[model samples]
Target: MWKNEAEPSLLEILRKITELKLFPLPEYLSIITKRSNEEFEEDDSEDERDNLIDAWDEALKSSFKQLEKYADYISDNSSFGTHQGVKGLEFLRVMVILDDEEARGFLFSYEKLFGAKVLT
Candidate 1:
């Protein structure tokens, strides 16, 4: 369902999720969420909501077994390390790259560091 489209909307993703019956997703609430946002407004809330939904959709489509296999391969073959994971360890050469968009979890906020968001 996702292969042909260059980009798919939230409604389309919800339908695909329902069709696949992916466990733990709200199959019944697809009816509610897939409905058009009649109260649409020009604000960050909508964008934030879309980001969360997109994250869920992407996670659902990923294969856990494949991810584990890749993790094992990276552990065996690569020196790649996460920021916190690499702490206290030294390497011959170090390079740092910051990618806030792909960063998940609440450990650190690159948004605040880069001034995209203000500290509360």
Candidate 2:
């Protein structure tokens, strides 16, 4: 997912593009947030699973319709996702977003990764 602060900028960019009228607006645009492990574990009941499954099904249908409308754009543009989300996937190019929160993680030390001291 894009950083929370970057969401506004992304929306503005989308708004500008839509105003240009180069393409039709999608019938649906859903942003599904990645659930934390703790949250997922908490919803372990069968009823909760069923509800989540139904929601996912609806989302998938909407996504397919959107893809049909903008197949070219989808194919050309790079997908933005968290590291865990892109596991086992391969792409010609990938840009990793390492903000302050991610920088402090044990898996990726900013200083070690970039060979520069982290100011924080």
For model 2 the TM-score comes to 0.24
> Per-candidate RMSD vs. true structure?
11.9, 12.8
lDDT of 2 by residue, 1-120 (tens): 235643233234344456576565453322222333364456555663465544643434333224333443335442322355444457766655556465444554433333234334
lDDT of 1 by residue, 1-120 (tens): 557643455445555666677754564345344544563322225354665555554443434433443455445542333466444346755655557676764666654443335666
Q: What are the TM-scores, per candidate, against the unseen true structure? A: 0.27, 0.24
Which residue runs does candidate 2 get wrong by more than 4 Å?
A: 1-8, 30-120
- Can you list the residue pairs that collide in candidate 2? none
- Best by the TM-score measure: 1
User: Lowest-lDDT window of 10 residues in candidate 2?
Assistant: 27-36
Worst 10 residues of 1 by lDDT: 39-48
**Candidate 2, 60: how far from true, in Å?**
18
